[model samples]
Target: MKKERAKVEEVSTTEEKYAQWKSQVPVLYDWFANHNLVWPSLSCRWGPQIEQAVYKNKHRLYLSEQTDGSLPNTLIVANCEVVKSRVAAAEHIEHFNEEARSPFVKKYKTILHPGEVNRIRELPQNSKIVATHTDSPDVLIWDIEAQPNRHAVLGASVSRPDLILTGHQDNAEFALAMCPTEPFVLSGGKDKSVVLWSIQDHISISAAADQGSTKSPGSGSSSVKQDSKVGGDSTTMSPSIGPRGIYQGHRNTVEDVQFCPTSVQEFCSVGDDSCLILWDARVGFNPVIKVEKAHDADIHCVDWNHHDENLILTGSADNSVHMFDRRNLTSGGAGSPIHKFKGHSDAVLCVQWCPDKSSVFGSAAEDGLLNIWDHEKAWKAKERIGTRTRSTSPGLFFQHGGHRGKVIEFHWNPSDPWTIISVSDDCDTIGGGGTLQIWRMNDMIYRPKEEVLAELEQFKSHLNTCK
Candidate 1:
């Protein structure tokens, strides 16, 4: 009975805090859009830009709908109209209903997935081509542009995958990534292995067909097709391709994997075993460098810095983010981290380096806050005088407290500078399905104080002249 009372108190406290946060949204965010989901989404990703205008741009957004068996699980392809910076009114951005959908987002199509979509990654070479990890051993690839849209009703047929990646001996549900430099795909699974496959042949065939090839796509890699329902044309079996190579290093379920932004041959993976293994395909199947004891608990996510290949970030159930310089890493020890960020109150779920800035990165967690950190501030803070009386989270310049539940996933918009899309599983806490938010921090908060002060001075002078 006492525990239940404590739980009630906690919920009440959270609600009060959320109320306060909501009231400050206009001042904290330059622009904000809140779209309530009908079902919870475990993953969300930004797709390619489709259209651009003076005021707004339309881009494709990918999301998953994890349904309750009465309906089929689906991969949603939506069109999001991103308002250009400073275009949206502060009042318009803040005044949004928690129960209503946003006008800026529209569902373009839906693909009924074979299983619940655990993760979704777009091929950098071709954004329309996406790979999804499900509760299966195989990774399903879909050409979102070519796939026939379907209604996600009960007993509906699963949308056929354009290509299927088969390698893992056990379920490969979560860890998935697409190479930025090449048409390579990477995945980690319960089999304790990291698998790599090149979809170059598939991409070539697709390109040739686009130019009017008479021959159908086949005869490149070893392909297999099997019938399950054994009925009709609607019972489609997708063509599957085996992995080019499989690297084994992790002792437990691999939770996340990321490719070196500049190279397809180099990549990294983090797992439940609390190990970070860096792999170079050119060297061999063995890990180039394995960092033992990378975290205190299961490492949930990892990100390789795009601008600096030497820097790697890992977030773990230990509720911390660690930055490791690959050049200084050694195997068989508590891997040395240049710095450890302790900001989240719970397990960190996702981490991504900013597309525009190398030193900036975002970490989302179960703590209901997405903390944005700039590691350069750690060293710079030391040069300041009387900045604090006690220790605080270094480099944490911003905390996005828009969600009332665990932030499942978030993606930084590459096209729209400083804009971010974040989703949270809010069914239990807020009594809604989930919350999808698109927001950008106010420029006044992150801009250099001196520059901002100068701009304010100019504004004040202009106001005095008008008076």
Candidate 2:
């Protein structure tokens, strides 16, 4: 039994080493050879062994095989230990008892229902090169660049028969709003400035949906609320903002900028500092809320809530995720995170809440695992989430092993409430196809479907009486 356990643990450890090295240097040839490590691809027939990564709250825990391997990713996967799972988000509370897990190994949640993991083949015509991913759901846009490759993929439309929108820039990473104040939109990028243009004025619109994890929205309001009375028929392609105003705050490259789904006028930014500044397109420089020490590591991504105004999610390099309360700033560091999600074994790449619900969010790490948690659950049982430093025991609802490369990005779908899509440029996570995958909420993690269903029905009946 020890040998069996040792073998599995060996795999987990080797792969882990590889992950650490690969994060900076894409290739693992030289690093692995120096460490006297055998390549899984060369030594084994089934290709490099895949390990499991679990994101406990915002951090990650990667279970590599039990070995003193050098490269983090190459350590073969080790024992599958379940840690704290499903910590929910509670209201206006910072300290909770949910256990904290490492970010490296966010156990891969099984997919009882594989979602539509299809790459778009019929891309919109006149599509330019790619720049970055956007959040305007349904449509993805691209940068119509005179120069290509530096940064393309401006954005994308979500559906077929799509309409593309893009930012006209040479080398700047401009902020291209699908819909901003009135029919006008704002384009802010690396040029260190913002340009306002009419949605139709550019005639050069590209197809886009701006796939991103926004937490909340005022129905159809655009970032930096423009005119209240817009269009009723603006389906997926409808413009978001009205009027035209450039938002300038950051002195350096703007790492991320997101509009509060709750109020169009509300926006936020985190970049080049230990600063997370909340903004209102209406006013510049003075952020509504400014947070310092947002993360010990660089803050990579932030998402607004879909319903609650006081709630927002952030992913950082310190290898953790945090829930920030916007509405209330407390003396007990009241505004401090209602909870700090620590589980990523490596730097967390991105985080997003389900478009349909704020409580449901997904986080990805450099270690290559995607994690889904009930924000509410993590908040309520915050103490029971991950392995406590004193004890290394796992919690329930955790995936043991999944993915073969650095999980770059994953997003929850709005149109199909239960669907999720993840894309990885990782060279190692899944051996070969480290390809994009689509997943749906399933009973794979929740076994005994009948039993779970019975529980849900019972709960529903109980709720009905209260209603």
Q: Tell me, by TM-score, which candidate is best.
A: 1
Cα lDDT tens digits for candidate 1, 246-313: 99888999999999988888999999999999999888899888988889999999999999999999
Query: lDDT (0-100) at residue 413 of candidate 2?
Result: 37
Alpha carbon deviation, residue 372, candidate 2 (Å): 0.8
Off by over 4 Å in 2: 1-243, 329-334, 383-401, 428-434, 444-467
Q: List the residue pairs that clash in candidate 1.
A: none
C-alpha positional error of residue 415 in candidate 2 after TM-score superposition, expressed in Å: 1.8
Candidate 1: lDDT over CA atoms?
0.88
Show where candidate 1 strays beyond 4 Å: 203-220, 227-234, 331-334, 382-391
Query: Model 2, residue 26: displacement in angstroms?
Result: 31
Quote model 2's TM-score: 0.50
lDDT for each candidate structure: 0.88, 0.42
